[model samples]
Target: MRQLVTVSCVLLLAVSGFAQEDSSQPRPFVEIAEQDVKPSVQAIAPIDDTNVFFLNKRGQAGVAKFSPGLSLIGWELYSKVKLNSLNSLGMGPNYSLVTASPIEITQAFDTAGDGSLDFFQGLVRDWQGRDNGVRITAGPVADSNGRLLFALSPFSIEEGQPPLARLVAWHPDSEGLQTVTESQLLISSFSVGPDSLLAARLSMPAYTEGYYISLTGLPSFLADSPDAVPDPLPKTLPSLLIPAELTGGKEPTQMCFFGENNQTKLVLTCPESNQLIEIVPEKSGSQWQGAILLRSQTPSSIESVVEMNSGLLLGGGPDGFFPLEIPAEAFRIESVNIAKDGIVLNFSEEVDRFQGVKPDSYTVKAVSLRGDNKTLMVEPVIESDGKTVILKTSEIGKGVVLRVVCQNLPSADGDALFNKTVFYTIHES
Candidate 1:
């Protein structure tokens, strides 16, 4: 390792906390304190809520101090790997950092403890798939134990070979990687949900050009050798969305959970769209399913995300860093519950009770698998709580996706509803 260029962590926190606050003009974001790392930033990982480390397209790794403002205390060139880009970053065991590139997964260590991540090790390298031009997508996702999972895809599939992608697992103590699940639809952007069934975002060309948000009852592979690519996940994906509006454009490539200890959210970052989408994951029985809502558009692209202890959100993209705040209640749908009769709509804020009782304020439609659609005029009932509106009707079908749009439902707090549309996938009971 090159002689470490160090910055003391003690001074970083102190300086970072002194971020000058301005109250005259109120904004949701924390103080602006990021220094641009110009080479197309791909991912970010928090050493803690107060500090972060970032990787760029040029394969350069750097550290920044953030509380209020971001201060680039130090950075390092990392390795002689000549890698073009680093796609993913995650905090590994013992405060060490993990990163993924097209060719390898590496871990960085601040062994000397001078606040510089000085030591580098290729934890999983010479991966077999790289020969076919492997691209590591999501992960370095840590389980309750310290083991890691990576989603991988190889671009060049030879004729007669399985046209497949994979979810690979690597143990820190082991010398190699193992196949977690190999599939024609191996997800590179997501993983198992609360039900332990893998819930993933699948690129569905059949639906147009967008991703098919999926919940699967697929079986994981028994861990095998590095070269052992396993069976493909069943093609009859226990999925949602009968092709809907998820066509023509792409969904975000990266996803993260933010807003810790409060309202946690799964935020998906799309650098191209300059928008972060929050996907609602709902589990019915053994299947995990849900919808994707355009959360908020950013001033800059966001490729990675993390939430600070102070509840402020931070995002990093191709152009560098951005300070962000969670989507205001006005720009969110607090929750969507499907009822046997109709559907219950929940607002993030106290919505006007009068509008909740108006059938004219609601537009309901159901799309069945046979390309059949049914429109409904529901009998609306405002619940005891002003935050929820219950619409009752058996007009919606059991096997169709119900799309509910609550229009003219103004909030009592004078906040306009940012999104009135919700898609509820009704699976076979």
Candidate 2:
């Protein structure tokens, strides 16, 4: 009887060791099940590599820790602000977290390093309830200098005044807020790149309901002077007017900047296409221009996207949290540059040649706000590079938005194009 009992103890110990080893191994991040992530997440920010911070509509902020088996496992609510809705969240220097609402920007501190932001201190309420009838619209991005920058647009306007919108910044080291720029167009969302190159998403909700994305070179003088009157950004990036065809039915919730200073790029989520949109900023002789193209797509609708410390993308949606993976030779139109004859279509992936050379693969439409829409038949000629397709036509017009429907275009890897359409605003050629 003693020998049998001793054998049972050894077997029990062996099973327990195996279970612990299996649970300790980290699981693949991409395999995060829908049930694992929180629902109705308004904004998501990476607190660190192993933890993700998220906010909800009820002004509740929480930290989710990534664990061995369950991805982003622990959901701990430690801070709650007075704002009804949290628009965006950012990781700041010398602070645990920073959040923006329609009314104010709040800073929190997790002094214990336990993901519990115990101290709620410092509120920037430079604007009042009816102060100029303006509210924070889009961002409160923490730039490299640790200054919190955001945009403000008027909720009410005096007749003939043309609602005033402003871009403002507040540094942690200073008591006075600096005014970046004051413009007539509503500055919806914005981010500052290397050397104060501002990439802003603007909208005119009252008059036209028009949404525009601008990549403008911030005036060098404004960088030094806090009170310098700046040039309107619409006159700078010249503003890419987004059309209904490009919007995929809803305006983008937020935009993010990534890559180096010279190769800086913008990425935003398109819920309708279930893809990410990339905007490449270009500068020539004091003028700023850029092109918008489709990027990668995930299985879920990603909103409130934030960059990870390791250069990865993490977003939340109704489905859950997921990583934006670099797909295998993902076919997409990388640029839509103006051509002498018509427009140039640049693809990120090498074309299959057979289907890419077909003119029917692209349907071009010249759209104007004046109720004139014309269809231009494309003559596709694949360039020698195997990815650039030149569409020869004479219909490219100024003040027009080109809606190009890409169909049956596949990459060399036999993958279909990620997005179906590309909208480009043409100001020249």
TM-score of each: 0.74, 0.74
Candidate 1 stretches with Cα past 4 Å from truth are 1-40, 68-83, 111-114, 128-135, 154-161, 191-199, 205-209, 216-250, 258-265, 307-312, 318-320, 327-331, 413-415
For each candidate, the alpha-carbon lDDT, in order, equals 0.60, 0.64
lDDT of 1 at 423: 72
lDDT of 2 by residue, 169-259 (tens): 6654343455566565777677777677887777656534435777766654434544434454334233666554455656765778777
State which candidate has the highest lDDT: 2
How many clashes (backbone atoms < 3 Å, residues ≥3 apart in a chain or on different chains) does model 2 have? 0
Candidate 2: worst-modelled 10 consecutive residues by lDDT: 1-10
Per-residue lDDT tens digits for candidate 1, residues 1-429, read 111112133234236653222234322222223344443567677666666667776666665665455434334433333344445677775556777666566766655544455666655665554655677766666543345777677332355676666666665343456555555664657644332345455665555534555555444433443233345433325366523342215455766655433444466776776776665666677555565565666888777776555566678876666776655555356667777866877777777776767888889888775768889778988777777788899876666777778777788766667767677777666
lDDT of 2: 0.64
